[model samples]
Target: MDTDRLPGCYRHPDRDTGITCTRCERPICPECMISASVGFQCPECVRAGSGTGHHPTANAPRTIAGGVVAADPHLVTKILIGINVLMFFVALSDPVLARELALYGLYRDYFGGTLHGVSTGEYYRLLTSAFLHTEWWHIAGNMLALWVIGGPLEAALGRVRYLAVFLLSGLGGSALVYLLTEPNVATLGASGAVFGLLGATVVLAKRLRYEMRPVITMVVLMLVLTFVPLGGSLSVSWQAHVGGLITGALVGLGMLMPAAGRNRALVQWGTCGVAFLLAAMVIALRTAELT
Candidate 1:
């Protein structure tokens, strides 16, 4: 056999060729080839797969429920943080804009009083209020907590569930504020939801057998600070914090429930449904009273 006439392996300089890895074009030995329905692929080539070309095995990308494609697990947290940062800039754009957008009940009397019961098409404010903050420090503190607590919680519970916790907690906070305070009052900030995350930490800590002391202490401190009335601003909504904490605690408990303990999915969903219904009821009642 003339060595010069032998086909060289595509990936290896010294090796003479067998058949190519139809997909990657790398040379494959007989022993390396794995048999499939259509053809054979080398172990290395199969492991280092390609999108197009001769595929030994046809495998489609897998999808989960809700048509969600798998992606980097951290993507949700990153996107949330980015949105918060963007909203912060938007809130800081003009003094008037900030007052109007930032959640404040009666503290900013003009903005709050004028907008209250006026149907200014600001219904989305309940949701947006979670993203807006009074100052850089407020945003920074919440973001830091989100990064620290959210990263681990999301990793443990998964993105969908983590998002549920955040959104529901925010809604719970808003609902509490709506129920307890005057409509003329406005409240803003992620603190309520962040506090809910703290509540989650407490539950998770218990589940994982981690010390609950730190979480409890932190929660206590947060509650204390919330009531301290920073800079004589009675604008802060303690009711929101309380509601968020309750919601987060319940959600965390649901997450911590054992898989073997009877249809955890149904239980979680039911809990969420109840919370949503309660929030809706509060909103309806308040709107009715206002009207």
Candidate 2:
């Protein structure tokens, strides 16, 4: 080991580390380093001789949050952005699509037709609305935020967990909007999910022991923007933003917290389950009220 200049982790090339695997002598990051009798060993070395009576297989890399490292770490983020953009274009082609998808408790369309809503068993709108954007600037802003925040988040949490947080956050936001907003008022945008990512970013920064000022500042600024009325007619749903932020923070805590080896996945998904349960409860209560 060079005392002057430490090498980067072999598993995570960008992470500089002073620790080396006792077995392979490869530099390992804190996440990849497993404590051994003599010193720290890489995951491969630990698994090879675990006495499972199985042959040693190749080491599959993992992210900081115990997620399988994919060849393209940002795949999920890209897919989400793509879906939002695609939906935007599709909505532009057919205005009816927006009316059908946007979240609302109940409403009447311009043609005097009664538009079915969440209260009328049109529950799919909760999710569809998150991807629906009527304005180019709205989609652009949300997608840009998604790319900036989501790429790193996806890399850290991996595909499955990252996707879970994004979706649950969106649902949480919808749940809040349904509970608080006027029944006939329509609301739609990706801001809920984007705000959720911002919340997760705060957790990530905290977990990694990074400076909190910038992350906190960003969150406050976004929240402020959410409340500030844009020309009175264009009002951002602060309820959705607040709901998503809180949900993301809770879910991020579950996903990022250190847990016992066998129970890590259990703990992570359990948090997601709890979040979904709360959102479901909110929806149920609101639906009961509307009906």
Candidate 3:
């Protein structure tokens, strides 16, 4: 605090100065001072200041984007919901479009012979069906579940892996329906992906050492409601739900496994990739059998 004992400039010894950095209280010369609303800070202190003044979330992982420190708010989930909502309107406006988009089971071959009840011509329907909803309530219910689970899972798994989980889960659901159900039964909705997220949450919660009783309870209730025949007009495709849950649980095991010396993120991606490829291969084989 005494000027007499004040040291010379940090960068130069000849020039003496009394100015000090407000943050670290280090002596700084005029040339080294960076003026601010509160006071002047040294070049070093200014460089390290929390740019926003307010601190970020405690213990939250930090990501840098556009030269700014920010927390990933899981925008992927919202984007997915937006896509589904948009598709819902499109499907609602044209009811015939929904049938074309739906994953119709492969019940018979082109020649009307037994073909494991799976369709062959419209293989793309497997993935497209997951995005289509029958009506307002259909999209609303799926989006509600997605809103609840998607953000947190995306935050935990990151955008790419989160997308893998949803998409692969949806494919798993459709693949199961195509292989197991009759061609007459048509299925569509994001329920399979929502169930997949639910299943992944169970695995993730267990790994994080958190209380999973609430999550498990919700799982049971959802599964029960899924199979319990909500109304005569609607048929619940339990096969797809089960398939998606199983796929999600498997993917979560790889994604949340204990880390070793290897680059674990890469390993997680590999795991998801292999699962996706396997789903695709299976769908291809199922469709191929018809021809």
The candidate scoring highest on lDDT is 2
TM-score of each: 0.67, 0.81, 0.70
User: Which of candidates 1 and 2 is the stronger one according to lDDT?
Assistant: 2
In model 2, pairs of residues that clash are none
Model 2: how far residue 69 lies from native, Å: 0.3
Evaluate residue 139 in candidate 3 and report its C-alpha lDDT on the 0 to 100 scale. Answer: 80
Candidate number achieving the greatest TM-score relative to the actual structure: 2
lDDT of 1 by residue, 2-106 (tens): 754445545444534345555666664322333333344555544455444656334322111111222454566777888889888887776567666654333
CA-RMSD of model 1: 13.9
lDDT head-to-head 2 vs 3, winner: 2
lDDT (10s digit) by residue, model 3, range 1-291: 764454766765554556666678876543354444344565565556645564533212221100112144467888899889988888878887877788885544347675433355667788889998876667888899998887767755666667888998998888887767766777888888888888887886676445567789999998998877755455778988887887788787777663522476676777788878877777777667655
Query: Which pairs clash in the backbone of model 3?
Result: 105-183, 106-117, 106-118, 106-119, 107-117
CA lDDT scores, all candidates in order: 0.65, 0.83, 0.70
| Regions of candidate 1 where Cα sits further than 4 Å from its true position | 1-73, 95-100, 104-122, 232-235, 260-262
Kindly provide the TM-score of model 1 when superposed on the true structure, using C-alpha atoms: 0.67
Question: Model 3: runs farther than 4 Å from truth?
Answer: 1-72, 106-118
**Candidate 2 lDDT, 2-118, residue by residue in tens:** 575557779888766566787889997645654454555676777676656644332335566778767687999999999999999998899888889999997767577875789
Question: What is candidate 1's CA lDDT for residue 74?
Answer: 57
Ten contiguous residues with the weakest lDDT in model 1: 60-69
